[model samples]
Target: MAAHEKMPDFDVIIIGAGISGINFAYRMQERNPELTYCILDGRHEIGGTWSLFQYPGIRSDSDLYTFSFAWRPWTGKDCIVHGSIIRQYLEDSAAQEGIDKKIRFRHKVNKLSWSSSPSMWDCDITVNDTEKMSLRSRFIFLGTGYYDYEEPLPADIPGIHKFQGKVVHPQFWPDDLDYADKRVVVIGSGATAITLLPSLATSAAHVTMLQRSPTYIASLPTRGVFEAIVLKILPSSMANRVIRLKWMLFSLFMVSMCHRFPRLAKSFFLRETAKILPPGMSLEPDFVPSYNPWDQRLCLCPNGDFYAAIRSGKASIHTGIIETITASSITLASGKELHPDIIMTATGLKLRLAGGIAITVDGEPYNLSDNFTWRTAMVEGLPNLVLSIGYTNASWTLGTDSTAHLACRLLNRMRKRGLSVIMPRMTAEERKELEERPFLALSATYVKEGGNVFPKTASTAPWQPRSYYWRDLAIARWGRYQERHGVVEIGLVTDLSR
Candidate 1:
């Protein structure tokens, strides 16, 4: 189909109807009720990660109180909610907010190109399992969550094809694949593996967790006193403060536990983990993390299910590199062979920007790899494109909520000022100063490989702001409505016509 031949449907097109996209749609509607909009999701449903992740014992690692939309408080007492419940909540939110009508399911966006002449974007989209169609809009919002699709099953393993038993990736788990009374081996140590181990152990004859490197794991009560206080005393506007206080204490303890006393920290994790296991079972260091807490994602055990599975003698931990995979067994580098009825690879996901859509300005391709200064949520040079990247440590929604507010504020300012687009202008020297800073060096991949070209302030965490909710709240508030950092410049055509 010709790009321009596809009908232009709305003023703005939002990709992915996940939390970010849903919230963006709500905010945009609130701003202009009559403005036309359409939300497209590659999946058949609205909930992005929540809907895609069907592994057992799947739940939010972050607290639910602060993990949700600021406008809607989580009424559930459990601070960490399960995947099914979370998916339900998202569906309810869409229904209650009347945003479901705007969503187009099973519509995947394949390519996006911007025309400088019209200052608009032409998006190539596939809908209803049909041939690709075109969608043009004034602006494009990329809400495609960071974790794109399912984790890829390792393809390099020798004789992997010979595995006669079922081999699955957690991202693409089969609905009817039964693990009951069957031996299951789960590979990888990230969140998905941790979540899958305990759940499968409940029914599986035996389950083994294999990890190449150790990962930090922490356990906390699903419900807490501070959470109660926030529910009672704080309004939605002030809830961020309470969340910040809670996060501060938690982060501090995590840092100290991992850094000050490594042995003690390891012991603490093992001890707590041991509680869930059967009386005679032991918590091995092989499953525990070697890196400092928060260096990578800290695995969460919401209700000690992982430990419980181990205690019941249904699960075991194996730490070593995999040598090869046979039809019914996994051979480790140490010559240990694990026989399994099912092998679940919980490996990580591939990171793609803008839903893996290509971007072009004035028919010239724009490479995000070439730009590196991320300001607020806006890429440095990209106009009319805003990204939704969630928090690394705390609640993912917290960052997105704040980013949504800031984005709305910026958009409103531009409209009121009669500006079409806004771009941050950093000079060669100022850009150089930003480039030389060590703070920006932490996320080398995000900068170097992810094509995340933007000017970022020194104050953001899990990267710079310390991952404390309180510190980030302050930074978010300060930058939320600031117009100076992100200023609008009239396009040449608009200025000339004016």
Candidate 2:
């Protein structure tokens, strides 16, 4: 802390200038502009997750409607957009909404300490990763998406250090690294690996995706006829609305179908792949997943790009355990050896809370998992902290519509009640009544392995995320904030104003 430096003050502090933070800013601008706020992004850039990764083929697995902000109309080509496009959309939306002005780039929160007596958060801001500054706010909204951007999960493999090939992790892709005409082997069966396969295969000598097991892959049209008709016949705004509605309904229907008829859904996925896959290609060895649909996120092959690459002999999928990594080659447990010039570990991201920012209540750093979540937006008993996390099954932004609205409600409530602090505290009796459950049902290895550290949910109402969009819309978005939401108590304050 600078001894003579004067701390800046704001009513609310939003951490992360990413899409989620931008959406929060838009919502606040729409209904609560009078509330003072600042958008702080840890990175030098504004695009959060998109800006961080500079991989070969980075694109949104989910469609644009659900991935993008609700209030903003996604006039872009339907869904499955490239990362650069998404990044541009974020910047354009922020600039158009005048939210970009509020963003302070390279401002990372080093330490967050809550002052119980003052009912405020004292944050240590590291400017440009160097100079120290202080910021005080009544509330903090964590828009920092769930993953550790600085350090990805360790790809600790046996004989990894002995490998002479250049190893790469998708999280931190060096823009200047030349992989053109290089034989590349990507390890993993998750979204990152699936996305990287076709992309690297385009120019690489050969790209081999090595996975321990098969992952469910589904191929959909690059552009739908109905989507084209809707956009062509209707106004852009109307088209966006109609398309958004259609996608939402269709997403829900698909989810229901997967749960109700897993066998049929699984068969349909394979049947579709059968059409696109190369003749005599065995879907059983590498494409078919043992888990039911939605048990894990289905690998989306928009327009069958991945399969097309396989058919063209540009890429291949290999499934087996790794025996060892030899210089210029990888030996599999199945006695197959793949010689590659480069090995890219598309393993997975490490799930983290608030981007690994240290948060303390009363000067004591509290483990996030120690307390259960509230409405999936905040931690129980944590005062004036709102973490905006999106849905894993659908577009990440879908959950934000409700979360931002709920934050507005809480802030408004605080003003109406003339209070500085609002903490949702529950008794032991209440905690016991709440049913315990895992936060995510995702079958992806990264997600499943993150179980111990990931946030927990209660079976009790308002404590667990219903995982249904409509439920969130009714309770958090449009509905009034009530006591059943939690037992929120206020601290003494002479004046409370947004």
Candidate 3:
């Protein structure tokens, strides 16, 4: 260490105490026990998405077996469960591993700057939204998922403010809000609306899902007889791995079928969905989406609860474009009107990477979009930084685990080489010749709308966004990442005074 340079407070600073952050912490402890680290979160609690969202009937769209960490088996009875259960699971995992002790809640990182002189990252943070502090670390792990927690995508209704009754956005659902024996209209066809309708219908007088268009709604079995038999036969540890692998393979197969044979997959989905709806109800505008299957994520309706609610005369679906909102009702462009006591906007979320923290390299502002990714985890020209974005097509944690393993491997390689800094670099000429692609794999609306904020991808290896699990697993475990056409460069820093 140079005499003029100050020692970093910790070797690594992980931002966010969510699933990815916890998983990374565990991997670091297991793979590199000598490295010191701490987790910083803006919120007072853990579980980034699970903690923030408190809407009724909030649950994981993906099965728990696949969504959870592979190291820690999910022994829950139901494959799909409520949000509170997930929160408790995360809390338990963190507490058990003693990772919770290293977390500093309410430490919101505002900006990060890479100091070349010290070969470290200087993080500017706001503690408890009042006191400001700065901390330095040799590396930074961004476990903050992509999405704006503070504000949702603006409600696009023309005259929503004119409505006299209560309006709610699921992102910030009020604990005190009541809709018992009252008519409610949820305005969106996405997952939140699908999940909320059944729960709201149980108590509300009438719950109507009003949407401009339809989204693919599919019924999923929470637990089947096959799973029960398997659990009964295999050991607890083996059963967990078996179920997790089964779901992983099944999910991949379903996605591949949808992508390769859209017409056949759409027909199969439509046919299966029609079987669950009430006899008199038609599948025309209510369940038939304009786009093909898997264009957007399929809204999983567990045990056909959403359809069951519709059959019980408590919930209904209305498809049309909203013209305006009146004091007591909403008027549609097709001359239809809906009178509800409460309105809930399940529109969508805005994408914000790394919790919207400003980044600078040697005092110059850093724009993530300008750089390409290395192994879909590290960014080009960014040293000792790792991003924990998950797969859009499958369970998020699977991709997260892959990134964690690859990051640990990179750190071990750095230690072996006696390197202080490592970055994925592309020659100016090579960068100019490379074609740019969208960072996210999904073609969802929000992804396309807010695409520019994320990093770019290319047609070639390493630069491409992480997609295939088996391929990425192999690469993360044993691929020569740095030998990919001179993309990655490592350096050993010398004394600052020299």
lDDT comparison, 2 vs 3, better candidate: 3
Instruction: List, residue by residue over 1-498, the lDDT tens digit for candidate 1.
Output: 565543356767888888899888888777656457889898999789889888777888877766777666677878788988888888888888899998989888877787655666788888877878887776677888665574443435567788999988877778899999999988878888888888888888999998887776666678777767876887854765566556646655675576668777767766666566566644454655555455566788776767667767788887888888987789998999999999887766555656666777777787754554344466656776767767665677766766666566655656566665665554566455442233222322222443243224443221132244444456544644324333436553321112
Model 2 lDDT-worst window of ten = 1-10
Which parts of model 2 are misplaced by more than 4 Å? 1-8, 478-485, 492-494
Highest lDDT: give the candidate number. 3
In order, what lDDT does every prediction score?
Answer: 0.69, 0.82, 0.88
Against the correct fold, how does model 3 do in TM-score?
0.97
**Candidate 2 local lDDT, residue 18:** 86
What residue pairs are clashing in model 2?
Answer: 64-79
**Candidate 1 total steric clashes:** 17
Best by TM-score: 3
Candidate ranking (TM-score, best to worst): 3, 2, 1
**Compared with the true structure, what per-residue lDDT tens digits does model 2 show for residues 325-348?**
987778888899999898988888
Clashes of 3: 0
* lDDT against true structure, model 3: 0.88
Clash totals, every prediction:
17, 1, 0
Query: After TM-score superposition, what is the CA distance of residue 174 in candidate 1 from its true location, in Å?
Result: 1.1
